[model samples]
Target: MKLELGDQSGRTAIITGANSGLGAQTATALADAGADVVLACRNTDKAAAVANRIGAKARVEKLDLADLQSVRDFADRIDGANLLINNAGVMALPLRRTADGFEMQFGTNHLGHFALTLLMLDKVSDRVVTLSSGMHSLGRLDFDDLNWENRRYRRWRAYGDSKLANLMFAKELARRLEASESSLVSVAAHPGYASTDLQGHTESLMDVVMAVGNSVAAQSAADGAMPTLYAATSPAVRTGGFYGPTKFGGMRGAPGPSSYREVADDEAQRTRLWQASEELVGITSPV
Candidate 1:
């Protein structure tokens, strides 16, 4: 069946980092679906513009996933949401700590979204979709150095770790939902090499490499967002499913069932990671 996001009249969605990149495109598509989207972003001004462009039904809400208090505040503001798109994220950036003192990439990419997802679980009814990446294939969880404090930090490695965590979290959350007998669904989607500001965030050397590759291999932000929108709204999507591009190696094509990282299927890691995340974020959801 075609994954169409139309006729979502009274449904509401909260998209983290919805001001730009895949997030912005997803917000626009969801608005087109007739959903009232909350553009949860760090930059209010940029988010406002995105909401304005999407239509007046879109609302801008300030959200910095890096801070627990900010996550709490954002969660509190939500009354009920039909969809929660964990679409906002940070990329390969230099070593920096978030407001909560976690490494920047892991903090913004994984933990921030982790905390937000848990905080908003009760508020969300139908589904939650997390944005992961293909780099997840190369990653292994470093439980010994979860924060990269003792080990030497590299940008791409940290990014891969976070992306891997995203998939793991999505899967684990699905399992938890099943155990709790909750109807809420959790799924993951990735934009394979999409052209977005993430490339601009890279170092100059890597930027040039990405810039060249992007011109040929990357899809536009709107195309990149299709899988996410599909996962969020498609009737055919099953809980715990992953979706992405359907072309060669999933680079670009119509949204479809996507391959997953083998590591994400490790039951032990999924359990351990879930417990650790719950402890770290200090929130326990029936899931």
Candidate 2:
């Protein structure tokens, strides 16, 4: 089923990772719906290519999610953003740290977007959509060692943790928005399993198997982008809602309410994570 995003005229949408994959597809849909899109990416050149294909309604900007300074700089330049899609991320990379020396997946996937969203809260008028994953089911909160500073880093576990954090962040952000009595909403969505270059970085044998499956059975990036666009544009979507595919354990289908591990809904953990994230990112609640 195709996503129907109605008029978004004169509004601006900032989408991270828009140079390719789901982000690019989401940007295309929004631009077609009349929203001016800003592709926030680490490489302006690659993003520019995506922008060219998107035509006049889409533009490019430098945004490195691994670097806090880059987030700050990018937020500084933008005045108003009607939609902020925190869609950029790294999956299971070996053992790499962000520029801020935090665990790569957790830092880039969770904290970077956390900082960016908080910093841009004043400019955002409508919604914030963060991309999570079904792998979040494998995750648990490790409050004492979020950065993996002392723990032995298991790449997949770390990735799961980061995606879990994405959901928690969205829920907490939604709560805060309510507290602040703001009209803006925070939502989360997972693309399920989409065929995209996002899988190219991992070298595990499982990666090879998954790549084969993706080539044979996975949904296209455009289909994978549906849930995110649905959460972003659908009036039926509520604050703190999480969306994904409706079939095959949420691996593929049209957009709907997605299942998440019960642990992800822990209110206390969400609060703790919010506090820890603010501490790690060196700030208080933007709300």
Name the candidate that leads on TM-score: 2
Off by over 4 Å in 2: none
Lowest-scoring 10 consecutive residues by lDDT in candidate 1? 1-10
Give the TM-scores of the predictions, in the order they appear: 0.96, 0.98
Residue-wise C-alpha lDDT for candidate 1, range 65-103, written one tens digit per residue: 888899889888778799999998887888888887888
Highest lDDT: which candidate?
A: 2
lDDT of 2: 0.92
Angstrom error at residue 145, model 1: 0.6
Q: Which lDDT values do the candidates have, in the order given?
A: 0.87, 0.92
lDDT of 1 at 89: 86
Clashes of each: 0, 0
Per-residue lDDT over 1-287 for candidate 2, one digit per residue giving the tens place of the 0 to 100 score: 68789999988999999999999999999999999999999988989999999899999999999999999999899887899999998888888999999999999999999999999999999999999999998787689999998988888899999999999999889988999899999999999999988887777886898789889998999999999999999999999889999999899998999988876678898999999999998867877
TM-score of 1: 0.96
